[model samples]
Target chain A: MAHAADRRCVVIKADVHLAREGFTMDVQFQAEGSVLGVFGPSGAGKTTLINLIAGLEKPHRGSMALDQQTLFDAAQQIDVRTHQRRIGVVFQEHRLFPHYSVTGNLLYGARRENGDLDRVVTLLELSPLLDRRINQLSGGERQRIALGRALLSRPQLLLLDEPLASLDLRLRRQIIPYLRRVRDELRVPIVYVSHDLTEILQLTDQLLVLERGKSVGCGRYGEIVHTDAVLSVVHDRGMNNVLVARVLEHKAEDGVSVLEIGPREQGEPTGRLFAPLCAAEVGATVSISIRPWDIALAAAPVSGVSILNQVRGTVLRCTGHERRMLVDVNIGAPLIVEISRRSATTLHIEPGTPIVCLIKSHSVQFVGALGPGSPQ
Target chain B: MTPEEWSALLLSLRVALWSMAIMLVPGIACAALLARKKFPGKVILDAAIHLPLVLPPVVVGYVLLLSLGRHGWLGGWLYNSLGVEVAFTWKAAAIASAVMGFPLLVRAVRLAMELVDPRLEQAARTLGASPWRVFATITLPLALPGVLTGMVLAFARSLGEFGATITFAGNIEGATRTLPTAIYTYTQVPGGDGPAMRLMVISIALSFAALIASELCSRWLTRRIGAAL
Candidate 1:
């Protein structure tokens, strides 16, 4: 659908065919003014998708449009050159012009914005080190400058292809907040290419999980993060569940969340589920991640313990590996618990063991989801 | 040294400078083509570029003379269209020197272009720079050191070119004679040994200067790029 003479931000809509070094990808999706993450391993066409979006590579038989502009349409015989496409791209290495100072590299993109210099500089927070040479900056600082340069272009859309991959873990952590600020404050939509689930969780609302050059799953993180397809790749050797639980009340004395888990099934009682450090209000819903390892099994109702979660349930299955065991407990629903083989033998855990599972309230992590009422 | 030696040394410098200036563009263009693009007959093009390096200097000179002489095909067209005679002239001497030095220039430039990371160009493209803009703003600047090295090597080669210049441009004094031709002429004349020895010393100095200039240019370029980012 093409809109004429309208100022809606560019919406990426394309099916692309890219084949190189024995890998072939044919991906199609529509993205608007939200962070859409192309998540996959290296060589899974995540960066290729980004390059295609930025017009760095052409698709052989696909049609792509950004905003109302026709970028490429093999049938229509239209391919707007990269410079004319008004798309900003940042690479993993930053790729700052080696011949320019930090200011000059930033202005290289800023000057292309047609006189919106002040706005971009303000938005990306690039005022302090404007005069510094790019090579003189630290890895995190260089990435920030690179981000500022991309933003200065005032592009309809931005594509980031693993901008933090080259950084050490500490530097990566330092730059992540700035990435969020860009998403929050700027009007530009970003197509972030990353294989890191942590980045996907923190920075993006929408996701396209790629495997072998194909989109195996695509949805908001809430919808797909726990799905069989997403989980198969994400939790290959582990079992974790992200539950949309409401913080019913906080026991500050013990630092735990009395979370209301699951939906009201018309007749079922809404019981309190204990989570680690309740950070939300009494009625505020937060997606809490429960790792299987944080749960413990007890054959009886053990008292006089700091472990606040003592849920009564029947053991569905007990599977043991060389060092660890996966115990499936049906606490109204199936909850997976991971324990060491020593603990399994010590507790004498087995299938159909009517047991109480204990979870320390501080072990639950609060992570939100992209629901219908999510911020735009 | 003597007036004759000074004249020959000055003539060599002039011939090399002019020849280098003439071939710089073509050499860079060829190098860029070889580095960036591939097509049918690419191997053949590569071989053709290296022909001057493989061929004997005298054979190269004879080929130049056959094609650029007064009655030859290109020479006839030049004479008929522009009344310009190239063979047996200083211009022919410069052309011969450039031919001898062309391989050196092309090889240096091609190596430099190859070393330039192609990812930088792709980054430029994503920044909304056109192909030509990327070449001008990114590729050309990054490859300047290599181009300078090529130019110096070519100039040095041109300064010492003897067989090609003598065969194509002849040994006329102050007209077609360059340093190498003058040296050739002096060796033939009796009692010209002193002048010939002085010219040989001048040739060595000039080659050393060219090398130093190339080294300085490369270091400066490296520093400039390193300081910027």
Candidate 2:
């Protein structure tokens, strides 16, 4: 078994073209991230992409390879069976076998004499559920068992197709931590698919954006959001700038906490911003999500403002989407700020122009605590 | 009851049990094939399996005689090669009963197998189970209640079989005579009403018991599988 620290990044390359009734999915991309977030809205062929990758659906023409093994090749007629591909999939619904107990379902696909069972059971906290029947489990418990079952197969690549989509808000929060453990402890390469931008951002920054069965953008979230193709898909979806920040100090009297954000390299400039007081200890890392539209850009730092955060940075790029402009700023970190076009003209904002991003302390929502092994 | 009537009742039970045993494997096989597969002649196969149910039982018995009798085509080869006789014997009575009861067995089991969700089988396949393993583990168990219902139905039908058994095997006392055949024999004689009435009550009671047992078994199975839905 490969440990997290020694596991190399898995590379996935696919050039698929499939046409169904009223829908055609023609996407091509190569991703090398340990967890590549597949982001798009409904009917954007997100599920179809997952099916194609998992060998549940065949493409009309194209080839796909995962780390060196060819999963499918239309010309070569090298389509591997789903079971033989060793790719685990956790579908939106918890597809646990109703005829089996939780332990039976987990071991259904496990290799004989493989000792990963106990480790996986402990990792997902499945000891209490081992003897329970599928129908007896709650929705959250069922989804966790589904995840543990997939992991016990020891898949080379795990495909999560909106594993949290069917769960309620609180239940979704319950499963995200176990998913992080799977990512950070097991070190299995994952392709996390979801329409919720904030949910995907909590797992990984590398993204593959799909729109209407097409590859709109594929790269780091901060760099790809500047493109118009990506912006149009995520503009009204509550897209947020997810940052990894360290707790600096807490001002109990003011009921606010300060966090330092930006590159962690020595001597590099970092910005300080006030956020709502959180229970995390000082010096611990936490993920903060601030909606792009919640940010207001100014030409200069203004004094006596009610907004608690005024971080100055240079504009990297700016793009117009309908009546608004999405400005990318580098305040020791890349952040996408959505402001109206009127403000853009008033401030004479363009690439290379220095600007101040004014944000209220309440806008900074803590998504989750980042583990030390979590990718930035 | 006289020794002759006792033999008739015993023979009827033997014939019913034998018929059920003979048809169990092939009945479920045909039901599964009809419910799951799609071949070119599927419609024709389905129609043939159901022909005995709709046709006159006498006609079915005549057809069986033509194909499996001593001098018949298949029977002649069997007689010459293996020296085995099938017609006008107790075995012929069982065969006739099995053929007449086949349609009911297939109908019940097919409906049950069709109700077993295909998605569960697909999930099994993805979990590294082969097609045969999926059928054994998922499809067969889920369809068990229907299979039992079909078996009981076939067993009841076999016990009451008359027209086909008489035509194919003939009513020889202590050899091919069954409950209905013995009843017909009693009714044809003078002052035979008492014996005929006694056997009539027994047949009705046996059929009722078989039906009640089937209902109880089906209820238990439904409870086991209902939670999955």
Candidate 3:
């Protein structure tokens, strides 16, 4: 996670206000991360916000800057054209050119002197698809090519408008690894927009939540998820806590794998949790996601239970929703556990209160396996 | 066929090809404009481009004569300034056929251009391609089948051009007499039905071959682009 600090520079600053026939979008936010996930529901002007950033749509007023370069300024009457903006976009539909082969499409926007084509093709595993026609590619293959095409353009910024939305659940999981590779390998900053919070969380914890064309919250996922505005939108969608963990060992006879969660400091409060056996080698880092409601909060450890994990942690904050309460617990890494309001009252869960978090071995799902070079 | 018939057939092919070449670029330009642009007088411009499709071919020829005839405004300027003669010449025959066939070319190409997905062009722009580059690399190639169809239609129209060629360029046997005009000339004399029928058969065969060639080309192009036009 130390590499994440290098990408903390502000990538985009947009304060734009637009009003079309039936919808109006007035949002102001600054994106700073290797990947800033834009999360919102349908008709929340998510696409419009990206369009304005990509220069595909004009804002009636306000200004935008990318990497501290002025992209659009209404008071200055400066609006850079889309092509001159040098921002590559991967639309939801792939939008590949029907006339060009895979190689041609990739090279259509490549900067020849840089010679990054081979790197991009190799990174995305596109060598075999080079000669194939666009229509001949599968949904996953087409998305890979689209991503490669945008990467080869040498863009200062990348805009992904639901790049995986068109794919099925399995296909989306397949593409997420490639996207992670791009984020780690490429220097280009990315602005990924999707309505699925789980999908966004898998990429980066920093999110810009949009509700009805307005910014509800913008910050770390753990810090903002408990807010009323973000909760209402993400509650029904099933919010999950995404964490990076390192494989400690595997108990093959016991049919469970042990993983060390959170930072690797000498005196850190990292906890070892049991998960289902996975193919990842020991010492490799993997991303795991667990639903909030899957974990039960207990006042103290129980010995006679069948649960595989009962890690002790201190509660940070608790927010009561309509029927459920979201308890933020710092068990090495921050985890949001959803429990009944009655449970909170019985357990006396509040800031600085010690508690035990109950979990099952199969509750943790392996979302993705990071490459060897990526730090945990 | 006699030398007279051979000359007529060759001249008709030459005129038809020249007509297609003359109209190809402008026809595509007009089609792209009509398909992708909006401005004042768009409806009027569209109607004017399609005038030949609905109006009599003789009237179109007469209008060309009025503007580009030897003593006419544009023709006189060309004659005086550049010492160029355009009336009753082979070039005039090509122009006459091109004018008559222009509407078909524009209509087919416009339909094709209209069918091109605008999102692809937007993607290209975001990929750092200029607007013109987007048109050349994405829009035009996707609409290629329609363009081929339009060219074939214009070529066939030029081959069968009679009234416009007759009215503007006159029926000069070696210079301006295309297939239909030659057929008309042969039918005028007594006992000339044999040559007239021969020329008529050649006209039908030429049109048929052009159509079949167009269909094959469009299919191949559509397959190359991997989509139905």
Candidate 4:
């Protein structure tokens, strides 16, 4: 709880308990990032947690504070109303007021005189949608309006509770960057709750893992998923290694792009990864998603091989189950490598052992620009 | 038409309009309460509202006459205190009609409000809107079609009200006699067949027109409201 007092970093500190229809949520965590990804399975209290933070639902007993402001404190007998708390929420259903047009919905929460309507309109590209009826907009367009409406309120925090859940894959991909832009431009602390870990991984680095109404773990993905139970959730779903890489070179002739992976906090560039096709401009930081199965471990960089991406890293941890081993390799940011028991034995892999990861350029599932001013 | 017929027709329109206009606010208020709230006596309140619907119209008129008529408790008090007489007058007829028509109005509006998604209101609250603002901006407009339907239903009821108005306000030729009472009076006398037939035809045409107008209006409102979602 004292860690929540970190004035420079932490924005949300919540310790709450609620029980609904036998599913209890007695979780607690302190979120300290612009976007804190909340990962959990079904009935994991993800919605309950954010609803408490937003003041939509009250906890039976607990305290939740945003910055120095106490949102709720049962002992203190303080319970702020939802509207007065000045928090914005985009529900999974995208509950835009059906009575109002796009502009009307956007400005519904702007109680202040100068509502900062222009910024949200421009950021979400809501100008054209202003006069349109809600039914007139496409799924992607409706979500943008919902996001824009939440932003216009100029709330202290934004809770996106599965905003992308109902969207199809293409629509989901379309809305992701707009979400990133909202975080970058508004700098509002966001608690993004999602059942799909893939969306959470794409949204933020820091995560709070909740399972069965308890805080299982809270840290970077590489640290939290190492827990046996959490790893199984990831293993069953076939989680991938996501690399934030800067587009360093684009050889259009060979139809390939060079992506430099894993930007350290304050050090030299970590390693190089590559993506097929001439996608994105040089110097643009892009997310490179690759499945562990797509990567092959090697003793050294194999020369004259058709494979394009190869990086050297140390093995951090190796755990085995059912003829398979999950080798955590620190190639700058930790990446999970799925290998069979045969390869684990043949490679003699252990913690602190240096190894090379082989990945074909085409195996890079995705590559796209993050934002305009993303650091090189 | 005779001067008495003209006055009676005009008076009936006035009574119906007054009845609808006076009941509109309270009808909607009660409907919203019944739709959204649960109190200790919610079932009783609900039954009280719909009692006029299930009971005979003459019975409702008797109740109104007993309570709010000239010599009854409330009416007697007003008569002695303020020299106001409502019995055997157009005002009594309007009150009787309003009481009889309330249930239809409330039922339509309540159903419409109930159909509205609660999540929409929750979303509005998170957007910094107070509950009152949410009702003004979200609830009212979304439930507009039902409200319009209720008002038209009330208006139609008042226009054709017979038993309650006759019992409470009496069958005065010009001052208190509405269209339904006038048609009844014409049929009860000699050499009244010609006027009676004309009034009967006029009554049917007016109701038909009213129904058509209500249909057109509610459909337009429903389309406009649903177009946004």
- What's the DockQ of model 4? 0.75
Each model's TM-score? 0.79, 0.90, 0.95, 0.91
Task: Name the top lDDT candidate.
Answer: 3
Write one digit per residue (lDDT tens) for candidate 2, span A1-376. Answer: 2233554468999999999999999999989888899999899999999889888799999999999999999999999887678888888888787667788889988889899999998888889989887888888898889888888888898899999999888677667767877887888889999999988987788899999999999998888887888988887876898887888999989989999985365345566889999877898877788888899998888999899999998999998877888899988878889899999999999999999999999999887766522322
Q: lDDT tens string, model 1, A189-244?
A: 77888877656655655778887787767876544544555656655522354455
Give the range of the ten consecutive residues with the poorest summed lDDT in model 2 chain A: A1-10
- Model 2 residue B229 CA deviation (Å) reads 2.7
Better of 3 and 4 by DockQ: 4
Instruction: Name the lDDT value of residue B171 in candidate 4.
Output: 93
DockQ, every prediction: 0.44, 0.45, 0.70, 0.75
Of the two candidates 2 and 4, the one with more favorable lDDT, higher being better, is: 2
What is the DockQ score of candidate 1, to 2 decimals? 0.44
Model 4 TM-score (2 dp)? 0.91
Query: Which CAPRI quality tier does the interface of model 2 achieve?
Result: acceptable
Recovered native contacts in candidate 4, as a fraction?
0.94
Which 10 consecutive residues of model 4 chain B have the lowest summed lDDT? B220-229
Candidate 4 local lDDT, A139-173, one digit each (tens): 77888888888888888888899998889876776
Q: Decide which is better by TM-score, 3 or 4.
A: 3
Among residues 3 or more apart in sequence or in different chains, the pairs in candidate 2 whose N, CA or C atoms overlap within 3 Å are: none
Q: Please write out the lDDT profile of model 3 over residues B1-229, one tens digit for every residue.
A: 9998999999989988999999999999999999999989989989999989888889988888888987899998999999998888888889998998999999999999998889999999999999999999999988899999999999999998888888899988888887898888888999789999999999999999999999999989888876511
What is the DockQ score, from 0 to 1, of model 3?
0.70
After superposing candidate 2 on the true structure, give the runs of residues whose Cα lies further than 4 Å from its correct spot. Answer: A1-8, A246-271, A278-285, A312-314, A345-355, A369-376, B1-6
Superposed on all Cα atoms, model 3 deviates from the true structure by an RMSD in Å of 2.4
